[model samples]
Target chain A: MMKILLLLISFPVFAQDFTGCGEYKFKGILKYDEKAPLKMSYLVREGTGSQMTFSLVNKSDVITLAPFIDKPSQFKAKIVKLMDGTKGELRTPMEIGLRFPDPMSASDTGIEKIKSVKCQ
Target chain B: MKATKPFVLPIFLLCLSFSVGHAAEGSKQFYFLGGGGEPEGETTIFDGEVKRVGSFINSSGWNSTVSFNGGHSKTEDLIKSKMGKAKNAGTFSEKNYNDLMNEIIQKLEKGELKSGDQLLISIDTHGAKRSAGKDAEKTHRVALAHSTATELNNLSGARTVDLDKLEKIINLAAEKNVKLGILDFSCYSGNLLNLHNDKVCLISASGPEQYSYATTAVSLGFFTFSYPITFGSKFFDNMKKGKSLEELFIDSRTTGDTPDFPMINTKEGLAINEMMYRFLTPYLNYNYSSTNNFSAGYVRRGDKFEEQVCRMESSHSDFLKLLKQMEEAAAVANESGREEFQNLREALEEYRKYQRGYEETLRQKFDVEKEIKDIFKKQFPNDQKAWEAYAPLDFLSLNLDSSITYYEGLAERDKGKKYFSGMWDSTVAQLKKQKEISEYVKANLSQNGLDKLKAQDEAFAKSGVTYKLSSRISAEAKKVYEALYNKNKSAESNPCRDFVL
Candidate 1:
């Protein structure tokens, strides 16, 4: 029983998916109905296995994401409302698109993708 | 129907058996009515109402205080001279108004506003209706005094006591287990109903499009002058008989004219009936003394239904222990004492009644919680996303999408499509709250970690796709809820026995 438990612990779980670790600049429109996008910056913290945290600046929002057991390389982040200050409203539909920094390329920051990788 | 099978009966039973207890001896009723501008405007009406309502409640044997800008006459001259603004503005300086509201909140936080108290606040002042845009309307607010620049450039600054600040004050009162009743006698005051919550009753002097009427004849607004004058005596009579605020509103008498149709939102049919009665009745007790009564249980705001449930259980357990101790003391006192025995007997009686009221209110709240769960189960029987999103519906204020989603589902199920559709339409008018919550989260969640996370998620997304993440988010929410509710249970086991009488 002990050996089996050890084996199970050692086994690589195929379920865990993308790991979007490290700081990234995230931008998204607060209101989906409206065309204007509110640009926000975030610090991304990726944990050992499946958890990832995103701390948004300016808006002072923090979000955590978890990978689905069935969906490979795809993580889910909660739907949150963002404020549209220009309209004097805090309820804007928010979506975050993250990009890593790249000093060499003026337009090309590191890929806009969450670095998808297998569980260790 | 099949979807409701698993949760329907169990949730109903849970609600039926649910009751939470709050034990606090000092219940102080606070009344803050400020019509910033008095002489130039019909703020004298505010002054009259203050005296009428204050004296009326006091005469009914309740400890009450009335705070307003009675001395604003001197301050007004100083502010106008300092800013070179209009002399007839009649409102207090913005700083003074903010300071008054802040003082009230500070006292409440300091336990001046205890559990089982009533907070009746009315603000009668000049108002302004500012549009965020063409699409957004009806965020009406009380206009305070203004700076010279603000007055010259834009008069919107006068609308300082906006919906968000008012909502914060009401939420604080609710947190203290205090019943909240607000009356706004300003232009477009009907929009003030956006502050409505459980245990809260709001009355606005005018509808969204109308202006509150102030007649020179009475030196006051019609609603302010009419409500207490026409119904003050009867309202107090019914109140003594344990009538709830909603009942008082429904049975209230009105005279003269209904030019500015008053709007009220009680969130009726919830546990508020018992909550308000319990909070207000103590004021009616002729023997009521702030220093004598002893409080035994605890009241803390919980973030989730499960946490609230556990807290209720613990509180009830503590209440039972207190009762047992009192009974033993009463038995010993017959042989050994007189005053202690009488005090014990009185404490037991008052506590039992208060405990019963608390439990009833808790059960009532659970009924609503159960209904929300039932609606979720019936609407999205197999959908995980819907279940997770709606789980928080029982805890926090319902966001627009969730409300519309629930109502639409109800419309689908019920044979009376007309009624449900109308309900859905009325909810659509309240989409402005979505904005209010968004701003509140941004301002309040800057410090706490978990709260910040929850606040961020509350920011409504552009579409339904974002809600898919709720399936994962629900687990974290449940853990946080459990931690919050269980944090104080360790101290509950040892009964509180230090009160002098």
Candidate 2:
């Protein structure tokens, strides 16, 4: 019950759909385990975005997001829990921006909008 | 037509001599009105600026407007009362903009304008872009034209200033030892960095390749609402007080209005230009931004990510050849610049290795998507309705909670470990900022009205699926990235790499 309540409390802060199921289900992109090496593990997308049709690699440091297109395109995103339950990736734990295709990001088609979920 | 040719040169000379005859006559500023006109929703801001600026000039005894022509502006009546149109336009065209610029340049060259004299231009029109340089994909350009003769939609007949030509003219004006300031409240205005200099200051509403706009609440250009220097702010008062161009630009950035980042050029902007030119010359379009400290980054796309990478691959190859010629042709002043160049060289050299691997990963992803489609077809190939539902490429549609966890897992490993430090420090800073902002922009702002999705988070977390196919895809991507970077190689391509045959 306490664990469930903790997840419930953390949902708003996490944003993307990161639920605690297995290791594959809990870690955030660019978010490293404090116990892990500084930059030994991260996932890079195979195709255009973090589409379900992807494969995750455990041995890279860069986490590139999807590029923008000509029209009102859509993509899936999720919130991730960081090491220590906060952002501590790439040596800047204080920087909390974790969403993909930033609304503030530039494009010709106005501001690109994104939807995200976080790890519980 | 042929008969009239003999008179053309003499007439041109006569006009040149005639234009040179009129000096600035000790005018303090050359305030001009332009950007032609806008549509119904956007017209109000242009109209408001005209009335306000025109009134300010008229009320002041300086009486220093070059000529105000709103060009079929709804507020034409107000313009006549104050500015006394020198040349009225049914609608402003690119020709009109060019003519105005020509007149200003002619005046500057001949007018004997001295130090502290100003040539001020304000642009509030539709923006467009075109190719730059010998290779179309390698270089890009920004133009603040489309000062139309009619509605913006009737673009075939409209005239807009060519950015290349505008840059040359603006820079020429700068060379006259006169102060030049431009307030371009249009899209792609920031990309016109060639016009940047101490003698000139430009405030663009949006960065390069970005669309600039206002909120649903009103159609005011983002710069209009900005503090201190904006139209709604103390524009006239600030002008009278002699605010420097730099101060006005800084003030504008402090209260950035649109979702798009506004840009101002300083020495830092020169650095930003380097990153934009060197790092971003590969693609025709991508989402990117710059910081006051010269940091800039472009977002990666899943759809055409490969194409952009491929561009960088080929462009990087050509760039190495140019770098090789540098010692013979040119030399960077600082030793550090050389060192930095070496590092960058190493990074570029390493590109094709991972690029080829990324291609493999993409093929695997497509193959997986194809497999999912095939599975659905085999299960219910006869049912057309079912096929339609499964048509979209959502191979494994996990619940919102599951989606979050999976992404987090990927991100957790990402850590943005640098494969090499060949890129500039500012470039690295920008890449980091882009990733952070990308996530931050989504989390803080209101998302696509999906309250329904949030409610599903808790219940859906329990329905996590572990497909064998998904794992296989993950393994493929892992191999590709592992070859490129790890935490251990964190010095950022330190020893430097030069692509040897």
TM-score of chain A of 1: 0.17
What's the i-RMS for candidate 2 in angstroms?
Answer: 21.9
| TM of chain B vs. native, candidate 2 | 0.45
Interface DockQ of candidate 1: 0.03
lDDT of 1 by residue, B163-251 (tens): 45667777787788666677676665666765666556776655443345442213234442323332222233344323455445434
lDDT against the true structure, per candidate, is 0.36, 0.37
Task: Name every residue pair that clashes in candidate 1.
Answer: A80-B459, A81-B459, A81-B460, A93-B461, A93-B462, B37-B90, B45-B220, B143-B158
Q: Kindly list the per-residue Cα lDDT of model 2 for residues B1-501, writing each as its tens digit.
A: 457688899999999887885453334454554433233322333444455556556654342543333434444565666555333432344565567666666777675555445556655544543332233221122222233323111122233344445565466756765556666655555665545655566666555554444221132555333122332223332343334544444333433222233455554444434533344322212212211100112222335556765675777677676544542232543222333344435544443443344345443444444444454455535532322322123212312233334444444444474432222232234334434433432343233212323433332232122112222222222221222222112432210110000
Instruction: Report backbone clashes per prediction.
Output: 8, 57
Instruction: List candidate 2 stretches off by more than 4 Å.
Output: A1-120, B1-26, B40-43, B59-73, B81-91, B111-116, B129-159, B213-237, B268-372, B375-501
TM-score of each: 0.32, 0.40
Candidate 2 lDDT over residue span A17-108, tens digit each? 22222122211233223344432222321111121111212222222211110112222323233433322222211111232223222221
The candidate that wins on TM-score is: 2
